[model samples]
Target: CATGSAAVRQGIRAIDANAARIVLVVGAEQMTTTSGPEIGKNLLKASYLPEEGDTPAGFAGVFGQIAQAYFQRYGDQSDALAMIAAKNHRNGVDNPYAQMRKDFGYEFCRHESEKNPFVAGPLKRTDCSLVSDGAAALVLADTATALKMRRAVAFRANEHVQDFLPMSKRDILAFEGCEQAWNQALNKAGVTLDDLSFVETHDCFTIAELIEYEAMGLAKPGEGAKLALDGETAKDGRLPVNPSGGLKAKGHPIGATGVSMHVLSAMQLVGEAGGIQVPGAKLGGIFNMGGAAVANYVSILDRIR
Candidate 1:
């Protein structure tokens, strides 16, 4: 992320920067074997693990618990959160590279399945995303540089936004800054949601997807779940999301995730995506979330030609 950001800063440096026209970003992770569970357990600890030896089974669970409390205190939506899990799992099936290619139906998810075990409260194993090894790369070029190329996609927009990582003293679910990032990104690109062909947001869990709907303004706060339940975020939706199956199905490799999101977005935008391609996508959006909803980066890309 810093690399891409630095490249942008350098590109705009002073006025006379290098003639570089392209920037490539890639994300890779390898978490095979039974170790996947243990590794995932550790990642969930980043949010709010009990430092005093409480050793909760999940960090996000702590957040989930907190979000639950927040909702109890400030209204919450359970249906919306479930949509997050269902959307990504369904999306993953089309992604041959995804770790968990098996898509569990909502009924199966609710009742539990052979592989879908319960993890944390309100967070079943199926509701969570995967930890797998994979890589995604992006080919970016400036508008002027891209126009000269026989094959290239336009760098329509790229904006970075930061959010409160430490959920300790803040409104956990009301991540307005995340919503702001989308506004800034779309504003810079001079387009609206109607202009976007598709979106690839972080779906670390069902709850994440639900919250993203609210954050991205796809739905009113807590209305994100409806998108999933109604299949509005599905492949055939007006605005298809996570055609690559997303992290839930595509696999999340931590540091590589952000880069991978951009890479996939570029692929879909350029019609390089095979089975996952939307009918007519001229523009795309990618939302990569990290470190307990603390860091969110959004990028917008369009076909250069």
Candidate 2:
């Protein structure tokens, strides 16, 4: 189901094992043709059907429950979630390939009207990523071969950690698997969170991004909201995040999201990102997960050429 990042991970493994000189990883999904109810039913299968099969709104409803839990533990973060939504939407305007290119201001995102009604739990329509149809591919080669290319982005480290599928087993809000994956990747790369120039994280829902700030060590648990409210994740902030507009604005085509993130990060490193470029970016981080952080993957990339 989350084969995008898994494909890249396996491709790199194959190269490391001398099984291949170059590998092409492609992720594609065509979902718009299906009926809304059918899409929801299909996506719901990714979750543990025994426990979450009846979740309202499918994946959105699952994340909505996570949002409610987060609000209860850390106090209401509705305003912060709205800020994230607005920020990503604003960033999307510059992305030529993004699904929604309009900048929805903070006020509009914060207050829901008929145009943006509540979807699941506390999440409004704007808070959830759009259902999209897309495809993205990237080529991975060994260091020696990549050096011969005109431009190359090397993978400093790539780590994947899977957690219990049933949300009933773990503290759903902690995203422990995500934290572990990030820590492992950064350690293997010999870098800290501060060393990253930018990040392209999975923002399937605004609440997910808010919690991810904490999981990725940008803030202490229950304090992630402050990062958004204080502009710490803005394009010009201390550590810019989601310069690609994230799934929140870029559109989440399920299978395509992970490879798309790597493609965009590679673009940023090579100065090909156009308006969404992070100035003087050297190292970029990517986080892509599936089924409420069950399949957590983190990659730290550096420009080698």
Number of the top candidate by TM-score? 2
lDDT of 1 at 46: 52
Question: What is candidate 1's lDDT per residue for 43-123, written digit by digit as tens?
Answer: 754554444124354554654564466456546545545555666677777766677776676666665557766566656
Q: List model 2 lDDT by residue over 1-305, tens digit each.
A: 45799999999999999999999999999999999999899988879999999999998899999999999898999999999999999999999989999999999999889999999999999899998999999999999999999999999999999999999999988899999999999999999999999999999999999989999899999999999999889888888889889998889999999999999999999999999999999999999998898999999999999
Stretches off by above 4 angstroms in model 2 are none
| Number of the top lDDT candidate | 2
Worst 10 residues of 2 by lDDT: 1-10
Relative to the unseen true structure, what is the C-alpha lDDT of residue 267 in candidate 1, on a scale of 0 to 100? 72
